[model samples]
Target: MSQKRVLITGAAGFLGSHLCDKFVSEGYFVIGMDNFITGDSKNIAHLTGNSNFRFIEHDVTNYINIEGDLDYILHFASPASPIDYLKIPIQTLKVGSLGTHNCLGLARSKGARMLIASTSEVYGDPLVHPQTEDYYGNVNTIGPRGVYDEAKRFQEAITMAYHRFHGLETRIVRIFNTYGPRMRLNDGRVIPAFMGQALRGEDLTVFGDGSQTRSFCYVSDQVDGIYKLLLSDYTNPINIGNPHEISIKDFAEEIIQLTGTDQKVIYQDLPIDDPMQRQPDITRAKDILGWEPKVGRAEGMKKTFEYFKSLTEEELYKSEHKDFTNYHK
Candidate 1:
């Protein structure tokens, strides 16, 4: 059989870099593409000389052109975090709408199955406890956070349209809170924010009363599940995340213990539209792909913590988060 070739958008970002690593390790010729608005080159720099990998500096919202056969496409390009999407709301919308459209067109022309990464944020402070695939979601289209939540929702709608109307092969994975190496320390996510403060011996910031909950899947487990979903026959969305849930306040306490820092948790006002509860049902992933998270929070956090501790003093102290809206305007 000929070697399989794959295109991974956002290939330099956290999850995208990991995905490139997975495919290359599996002997696939991987094309790693990223616009780098929020992605760091350091994340994928190690693959620089690897024969099986090629890096493309381009945004998916614009036209995409590749030279040869592409067996699959993982359209992971988007401003994922609140810090990112809030800073570039227009870019976020374009990537979700225009970028997704470009990728679907490429997939159609190449006869390649495509997978667009969706998020549990679609569940938007969900009325359901542990979200399942059928739950539509509770979202505010006008809220500041809506740019991201609605984009993914719209992304899902278009994906299903492609599948039903055009006979295109498609897969969707509703990613939950994920953490590990390469997560930005100042990107305004719970895990990295807490870890960065702990590393610097500062108080861990807990938004809201800390009762807001999140389910974090280790990077390995998440990547493995995505790999399975792409190859599987299931075209609908599947939730891939650890079922283990932790309250934000309690998670702050866990970090205190993990880092053994003298700092204590401090409360702050909740961000607008933060989810009160989040945990994936994952019944479909369990039954269909036979996949469940193998790494516990403690074990995964250990690996993640060590990575943060290894960051340079400059990176650890980098307080400013870049905003590209001015440039885009």
Candidate 2:
């Protein structure tokens, strides 16, 4: 039997890279696409010599040209982290809207099953607790963070259109807070910020009153959920994340204990439009995909810390303070 062919955009990113590894390990011909905008080459470097894995340096927002048939297309492009998106707002919006459109067009042309990566941010500062797919999100469209949140919302909208009108095999996974290896030390995400501080013997910074809550899903669990969803028959958006929720302050303390660092917690002004609470109601995922996170926070954090510990001292100290040109195409 011939191997299945999968095309994964943003294949050099944290989640995208992991998806590539998963598909390749499962005996699929995985084609990785990336522009290195916010992704690091080192993430997919391990598969450089693999026969089944191929790399393409291309931006999805631009015209996408891929030869041969694609059985599956996992549209994982776009700047995911807050810091990265804020720095490259235009590109972030373009990838989510234009890039998703291009991927959908490609999938339609190739008669492939397509999956798009949506986010918890779509539920922006959500009013509902343990957000369900039915809840209409509370979002400020003009807010700074709106660039990302709205982009993802648009991506989901167009994907549904394609599924309904073109009858394309499509799936959307609204990912919640996920963490594991390959997370950059200075990505400006709470986990990386706290972990970097702990690993460097610095005080961990907590934004806001620290009462804001988030549910974290380990990468392996997240990937498994996505895999199940891709093969499932669902067309509407589904939440795929760990239902385990924790506050920012409490999570920070957990990081301190996990890293064995004596650093005290420090407070910082909360960024505008930061979500107060984020927890996915995975009832749909459980019933539909039969998926739930298996990795506990303690175990996941330990593995993540070890990965960050292996990085060079320079990478450890490099500031991720976003310093990029504004709104460039």
lDDT of 1 by residue, 1-329 (tens): 99999999999899999999999999999999998998989999999999999999998998999999999999999888898898888889999999999999999999999999999999998999889999999999999999999999999999999999999999999999999999888798889989999998899888889998899999999999999999999998999999999899889999999999989888888989988999999999999999999999999999999999998899899874885855363
How high is the CA lDDT of each candidate model? 0.93, 0.92
- Candidate 2: which stretches are off by over 4 Å? 321-323
lDDT of 2 by residue, 9-103 (tens): 99999999999999998999999999888888999999999999999999899888899989999999988888888888899999999999999
Best by lDDT: 1
For TM-score, the strongest prediction is 1
Q: Model 2 shows how many backbone clashes?
A: 0
lDDT (C-alpha) at residue 118 in model 1: 96
